[model samples]
Target: MVVVRGALVLSLVALLLGLSAGPATAQGPKPTIVLVHGAFADSSGWRDVAANLRSEGYPVQTFDNPLRSPAYDSGQLEKQLATISGPIVLVGHSYGGFVITNTHDPDVRANVYIAAFAPASGEFVQGLLNPITYPGSRLLPPALQLKLVENDPTGIGGRNIDGYIARPYFRDIFAQDVSPAVAADMFAHQKSAALVANLEPSGAPSWATVPSWYLISTQDRVIPPALQRFMSSRAAPGRTAAVDASHASLVSRPADVTAIVLAAATAVQR
Candidate 1:
């Protein structure tokens, strides 16, 4: 009787160990992070952020938006989201914000907006940028200004180059937290699309239903700081932080952006 009891106890222990070391336990679910890049930018813009997220054990992927019409872009993004089998965290930058807002999937765990747009229902990018037209815009170096204008008519007209330079206009607008080298790299690689100009308004806002967190760049030059605040106020009233950087807070302040995303991911598990 004593031997039989001892044998039973040992068997129970072995069973428990096997369960704990099961194949299911060995292969854990991979956390998915889908990054959406904004206008005048591409997936390359999130290169640093994506690398940082990966170093920390995340399975990160970025959607290369054509920057076409908003609906067209959103449709493409949704197709990408469909491929993700598990819960996902969607991160959007600049005009990419509108894309996330429009393509938000119910399966997504959360939405993270980094110095990016968070348009409301029935609102478009123009609606957000038009309301905050400020006084004399920042000044840019004459040569650089001419480059921006000459190569891109979308830039401040032929005459506004100086005003476009002095104030850290475009660079500050997108990537304030990043280094000069990174920011310059971002600018050089920047690609503007005519479709971006035709992006339509958003129909249903993802933030209204999904958990959202916003990282507002206080020193932003492109999408005025006030405008970012307003967007956050309406879209993510409770989950917002003011970061002391320019527009590209994700690149400049990668840790903060990652923290916000990590917290959101944690909540999804609950």
Candidate 2:
């Protein structure tokens, strides 16, 4: 519940995003900003955010996270990180945060979570499921719709399943803060994540050693704002910010999200 304003307000983005770091980087080049999207959405959701970052002269790449198990997805992201040079400011939104939590990428100088899940060791991002644990979260049954897909072989048989936010509840749960047109567009383009992702337990969180940041969306109907506060506090982030936006604040308020990313990037560049 910390209030940030003026110059210090800018500094809070790193802590708000739940990025906890040990030491400042020695003189180095600007780190590449790598963004990971979460469930029910695709890289397209980051279209505005990436454009803003690139406009700031940052090298930004929105990773098309395969909506699979955390372990498998993290492996994919780790491989992608290895191909890129220099340090990285790894950012994630929603379940994408769950995926990033499992990575141990050394080049990742800072972690920025934008209304995303930042789970701890052995913690499942599915913690969102407990109504008692995370009050006010409406991302539950009925609001969520699951579709079965074949040819995935990684399921309980030779089939797979994906979860999508029901169209009727999509705006209410994920993007109530945005305009109807934008929210509808987002829903139209949203991609489903593997339902098994909710079942996978997170490994040792990378934020512990990589320095992390968190941006909590106060009006978030997806993940409770209380949960965001809990996660950010648990991470012991060096900086943090609370925005009165929805879970899709990254869409309605990309600037706020970018401020946190910039703070993390500046911290790593130092």
Top candidate on lDDT is 2
The Cα RMSD of model 1 versus the native structure comes to 12.4
Please provide, for model 1 over 1-270, each residue's C-alpha lDDT reduced to its tens digit, 9 standing for 90 to 100: 001121233233224322121121124354599998876667886766677667656789999976655777788999988988888888888878888888867788688888788887777765666743632123224412322224433334521121112224556555656668877877776655443333467878888888787878788766778888878887766667777876767667666566566545444554
Instruction: Report per-prediction Cα RMSD to one decimal.
Output: 12.4, 4.6
Error of 1 at 86 (Å): 0.7
How would you encode candidate 2's per-residue C-alpha lDDT over 151-241 as one tens digit per residue? 7766677688888899899999999988889889999988887877988888888888887888899999988998898888876354678
Tell me the TM-score of each prediction against the true structure.
0.73, 0.89
Q: After superposition, how far is residue 46 of candidate 1 from its true place, in Å?
A: 1.6
Location of the lowest summed lDDT over 10 successive residues in candidate 1: 1-10
